[model samples]
Target: MVDAAITPPSDVDTLAAGGEHCSAHEATGHHGYAGDAQALQNRLRRIEGQVRGIQRLIDEDTYCIDVLTQVSAVKSALDRVAMLLLEDHLSHCVVGAAEAAATSGDATEVNEKVREAAVAIERLVKS
Candidate 1:
């Protein structure tokens, strides 16, 4: 279904207006989440544990509602992680684009950055 198709990209790199790499930070192997990388990793690990627990619940023939409840919890957890990532992207990547545009006198990069963020946000809302 639609929800099943909604998955986060492994890498959020995209080309700019002129076919140039737009994500300067990602180009250099530095992500917006670099500072909170460890914390994010820890959260993802915990989510993985939760997912395994859900599998165990199903294996044990747990009530359907109980399984669904756990599933909702996991979804909520993922949403939190996504939000953190979005915040990092806006603060670092989008702002960097704006700064670069200030000197280059071309808003192409900034516009593309904003469009990317909007698309990401729309996907999140749909999910």
Candidate 2:
């Protein structure tokens, strides 16, 4: 996924000013959205609907147990989404970064990607 348009590091730093980029992937195109984009969108839509339903139930003063059940379902659905995203990230971005590091002495990029993923996992666990 190397980008021919990629500038030198300093040039990139200047060019990318005001853009959201913390990882080398932004320039290298090494990390990207992977696998079944439509499916991911569908899953997210379902989860979004589920959340709205929960809000409706709360508004209508649904029974405590029923609300709790919906809450549990939402949590499970969200967990599944997280796992799916994690799988894609591991199989694609993380692996790509590591391979690039091994072949091209870009271990810093791999380390950065891993650290980013670790932080995401930590946030998910906290949630």
Candidate 3:
């Protein structure tokens, strides 16, 4: 297996090539569905507020451990958000790409997506 920490040159090239083949198909729609978008936005808003709170905590000279605890919470929350996004991507993007490739008899694109997903999962595990 390839080392997930080190992205291959070909993978970099494929990604840099505008990701055109990968970008053209997605179920989330460019703007995403109303419900999912709104939910994500709300989470982001809460995260933003958390960040502001951290700032205020610093300004008020709050206890170090309390601030660090809040920071850890923020990290965990952000990780949850990332997991959600990854779930969405797999369900919508990866599935659709696989189906399309199967129908077209072109497995290369879908294989790349699978590799990308594997790398992502590895990174998540490491983190």
Best candidate per lDDT, number?
1
Kindly list the per-residue Cα lDDT of model 2 for residues 4-123, writing each as its tens digit. Answer: 122223222233222233333554554344446778889889989999999999999999999999999989998988888777766666667667766676566665555556666766
* Candidate number of the best TM-score: 1
Better of 1 and 3 by lDDT: 1
Please rank every candidate by TM-score, starting with the best.
1, 3, 2
lDDT of each: 0.77, 0.66, 0.67
Q: Which portions of model 1 miss their true places by more than 4 Å? A: 1-29
Descending-lDDT candidate ranking: 1, 3, 2
Give the TM-score of each candidate: 0.79, 0.71, 0.74
Residues 98-120 of candidate 1: C-alpha lDDT, one tens digit per residue: 77767676666676666767767
Residue 26 lDDT, candidate 2, scale 0-100: 52
lDDT of 3 at 118: 63
lDDT of 3 by residue, 90-109 (tens): 76656666677667766666
Model 3 alpha-carbon drift over 4 Å, by segment: 1-35, 122-127
Compute the lDDT for candidate 2.
Answer: 0.66
